[model samples]
Structures are given as C-alpha cells and as structure tokens.
Target: MKDSFAQLDLTTEGFRLLFEATWIQRPAGLTATATAGEWRAVRTPDELAAWALAWSDGDEDEAALFRPELLADPATTVVAGHDPDGRVLGGAVLSESGTVTGVSNLFAAGDTDPAQVWSGCLGLIASDRPVVGYESGDDLTAALAAGFQETGPLRVWLDA
Candidate 1:
C-alpha cells in the first residue's frame, strides 16, 4: 500500500539555527556548521580516535576505520538528538545533499511528529523531491497525523 505523508517546515527561528550555525565543539573531531554532531576540531590521529570512540555506543574498536582528514571536513553533516538525560538517542550523517546515507537508528514509524519534522528539514534542502518517506503499521491514526490517506477500506483480521 502507498500513502502520502505530511511535510513540516521549520519556523523562522528554527531555520536560522539550522542554516546559520558556525561551529559546534564536539568530542569527536571538529565538524562544520553543516554537520550537526561534530563537537571539536580533530587535529591528530589520537583526537580522531577519541572522537570515534565517543560517537559510537558499543564495544566496537572501529575508530581506526575512519579517515583522519574526513573528521575535520566541513562538507560533512551530522545530526543528533538527546534524551531528557542528555544522552544521545538518535543521530545521522549526510553529505551536503540531504540523503539518508547513514542513520544511527531507524525512525519510530509511529511517531508522525518526528517524521514530519524530518521532512520539514528535508524540504529546505531538497525541494524538488517529496520530503516524506513511507511508514507502515496497524495504526492509521499516526498516518493521518502525517497527512496520509487510508488506501482501502479498513479491515480487522482475526485468527479463527
């Protein structure tokens, strides 16, 4: 089944924050304003290693996999969100173009608001394409909230 989803646009203030950031001091190598999660300037191999460790969650000694030069590149984009306790719950990285090239976690498909927010942000960069993606579940209310139309007659199936 196919459904259309709502697109959200940032408020003027949010747009300002999204577009006008200069620098973010990150624990992992320094990132440009375009990149969301980068915290500091990564100048050395040690710094790059530390930054990689800080960004990852589990026991994966994969920091060495990173190219040191990429850590400081401004063209890279990172985005992150924190829980109430200030721990990261979600994040992603994108090239200058808005593509879901990498994601930390799959989106909570039921949460239309967050999905709308993402679409809104995407609208800013990729205006030609439909900013929203597809989501599937038993819950149609969530889809409605995201501006989706019910594709067929609602039916409930039960085990006999």
Candidate 2:
C-alpha cells in the first residue's frame, strides 16, 4: 500500500499520482516566502512515498511503510508546509513507533530558530512513540532540545 514510488524510481508523474491519490486535505494555516507552517495529514501509500523521498533522502523502507494503503488502520499523521500558493515546501508524518518516521522538513528560513519548530512538531505527537529518521543536524538538535534522546546506536541500510 505504500504507493510503490520507492519500489521503482521517483519522478514528477509518480509523485503527482501518489499525491493525488493519497493526499487528504485538512485545515492548516500557511504563508508565503517559504514559510509552510500549516499541516495536512497524508493517508495513502503514494503520498507517503513522495514525502519520504523528498524529506528523507529517498528512504525506501521508511517511505514504503507510510503508504496510505498500509496505514489504513492506524493514524498516519501527515503535516505539510506550503507556500502562499499552497505548494508543498516541506512536511512531516507521524507513524506508530515501528512504522514510518523521519526528519522534519520545515520551510522556515535560516534565521528561524529550529528549536521553535522542534517544539511545534513535538506538540503534534502527544502520547506517541519517539520520532525517528531526523535529518541529523538542526532537526536532531531540535529534537534534543525538545527532550528526545537517542534510543540506540545510529544505523542505516544500503543496497549492496
């Protein structure tokens, strides 16, 4: 159900298909100038694949699990940052602990303090598992600032 985008290769058409098929519109506040603070949840595999590639550097397993079809039973929380025109600049999704997770792709400018954004994302996940796959810079800094610590040694899998 994870939309199969990662199963093959990522492309604009594939992304579009995934987005159109899996994206769910929700009420979220957004702004221009690359400040996408508003959030809408994703519920389809294709949407999850697109988001994962864009945000997590094409993490296949992470993206695959987020497929809307697979998350049908649980809450696959999708949050988006949009430009004034409502194009997605970045986003994040919350999955059950063992499901999909990655760094926060906020669209705030460099001057914007990452700690603040970290707090915002933390606020979204109440009574959930520890967030995983953060981008490992400001994102990780923000997570630490917001009271999340590493649960184990860092690990990554690559194709041989």
Q: Clash number for every model?
A: 11, 5
For model 1, how does the per-residue alpha-carbon lDDT over 18-42 read when each residue is reduced to its tens digit? 2111111112221212322222223
What TM-score would every model get versus the actual structure? 0.31, 0.45
lDDT (C-alpha) at residue 129 in model 2: 39
Best lDDT among the predictions, by candidate number:
2
Task: Note the Cα lDDT for every prediction shown.
Answer: 0.34, 0.45
Off by over 4 Å in 2: 1-36, 43-75, 97-117, 127-135
Worst 10 residues of 1 by lDDT: 17-26
What candidate 1 gets wrong by more than 4 Å, as runs, is 1-57, 63-68, 97-160
The RMSD of every model to the true structure, in order and in angstroms, is: 16.5, 12.8
